[model samples]
Target: MAAAQNTPGQHRGMDWCGFAGFRASKAPMQAYAAELGATMQLQVQMPRRQPAPADIVEEYTYTRHFVAIDDPVRLLEILPGLPADKNHTYEIILKDKPCKLCVDFDGTDGLPACFASKQDFTSRVQDVLTDIFLTEFGVQLPAESFVWVFTDYPVKFRAHLVEHHIMPDGRILCLPQHNPTHATRRRQALLQQAGAGHA
Candidate 1:
């Protein structure tokens, strides 16, 4: 599920991240939370485990896009940590519209693991997703569709849309704008003109 994140110049707090609750008290989980807490500092929140009944356990409440990650390295990289066998879930933000994409790659050889390099992983995944969306959803995209696309997954940091190329979000930007060849555009225009003639 996606939650509203704190935009720049906005209030910096759990309230801003729309962060909910979960508990992780194990040594690794605790260490991960500590590191994240220290790293995020004032930009985000990492509260300690709240009081609860002994029988009733809780999970660590994460204030980020992705969730249920055990590795600090992967989490910090804004990647998921699931077995290669399992399908990974990603939130694709196309033209400012978010959609869930669950995909399972065939054959593990050279296949991307869940928690790989944040930017590289996202770039590669989005490339394939663009094809899928464009073909399945149709050539006419939403009004908000832009030449470039991105996601809200927080890597070393969270990347965002802004003027001057793009604001740094810790992940290196590698996504190229969708530029159709001139011939392709001409053919599309001809097709439109022909259809209009029929109408």
Candidate 2:
């Protein structure tokens, strides 16, 4: 079940940037990365967070490409030297090319899974935050655990997350919000349909 820890004075009413927290787990990284070496390729895969009971997915996420620990003895040595509290991790930018990432938010209701760029690397953070929210609370939250919602509507052509689809986990997944003009037009069309149906 997902759990949350709130930070003080961080809430901005119903729709602004809010901070919802959850219980973090011990890092299973060292054991996970042990199958690495110069000759033997480490087939890396990480578990994706499930927002609902039925949606269990896995993403092949890695920060760095290759950890050049060819010697068996060296692998045992430096692993212990890494710091703790590494629940949140990043992929290595390898010498061959930048590491490709595939991220899923909540794993239940997701924005499409695609390769991310260096500029948009931070966006995957939403995936991490959503994972914690869903896994701990047993609820699929909006792509929000630590997110900055706009104070006003149509912030950079994107509207608010007020009315949206509620997932099985009680999370709201709103359609991509755009400019006020388009949203207003869509709302007008919906209202017209409602009126026609009543008549």
Candidate 3:
């Protein structure tokens, strides 16, 4: 998954670089860090959780690693090889600036209990990447600026910008344009109303 060489006008003026993955593994993280000529450090946090058994409480812990790169260009060069998993979380922050990019994979199709069926996972990821770019760099790039080069996942292109709608009060609204279930429910309601009007 080595990143392709940057062509003219491609990702120009971009000082930030990061990758998104669904449940990506640690091996890939280390690999990416090595490629970027950086060191990786792992941090583990333990939290307690209480379930139906009120008397019993359980503690769980998760580990996260931090990789700092001096040059973002090095990070950008290895974008294609980054892990793309839904179960794990990964991020890299620039040491010089307050710029960072993170990928959230909790609700994606990777979690079967949460997502029984595969939704438009790639499009959602693209929207999130776009939003992050906007937030970090304050630049709005065309949807095509981001591309999913992994062949393991279904090929997807951006249908519309779901997270780009910014309200006047400074709140962001994510209105998915191609939600099948929402569209179905709305269609059903419309048909019912039309039937009632005729009766």
Most TM-score-accurate candidate:
3
Backbone atom clashes (below 3 Å) for every candidate: 7, 14, 9
* Per-residue accuracy of model 3 over 92-147 as CA lDDT, tens digit each: 33433332222222212222232223344444445555565579767674665443
TM-score of candidate 3 versus the correct structure, residues matched by position = 0.23
lDDT of 3: 0.36
Best by lDDT: 3
Off by over 4 Å in 3: 1-92, 107-109, 112-119, 125-140, 147-199
The digit string of per-residue lDDT tens for model 1 on 19-89 reads: 33322123333344476663321122343356543443222333322233435464445422333333233
**Residue pairs of candidate 3 with colliding backbone atoms:** 21-84, 21-85, 22-84, 22-85, 22-86, 23-85, 23-86, 23-87, 23-88
- For each candidate, give its TM-score against the true structure: 0.22, 0.17, 0.23
Which residue pairs show backbone clashes in model 1? Answer: 22-59, 22-60, 22-61, 23-58, 23-59, 23-60, 24-60
Better of 1 and 3 by lDDT: 3
Backbone clashes, candidate 2: 14
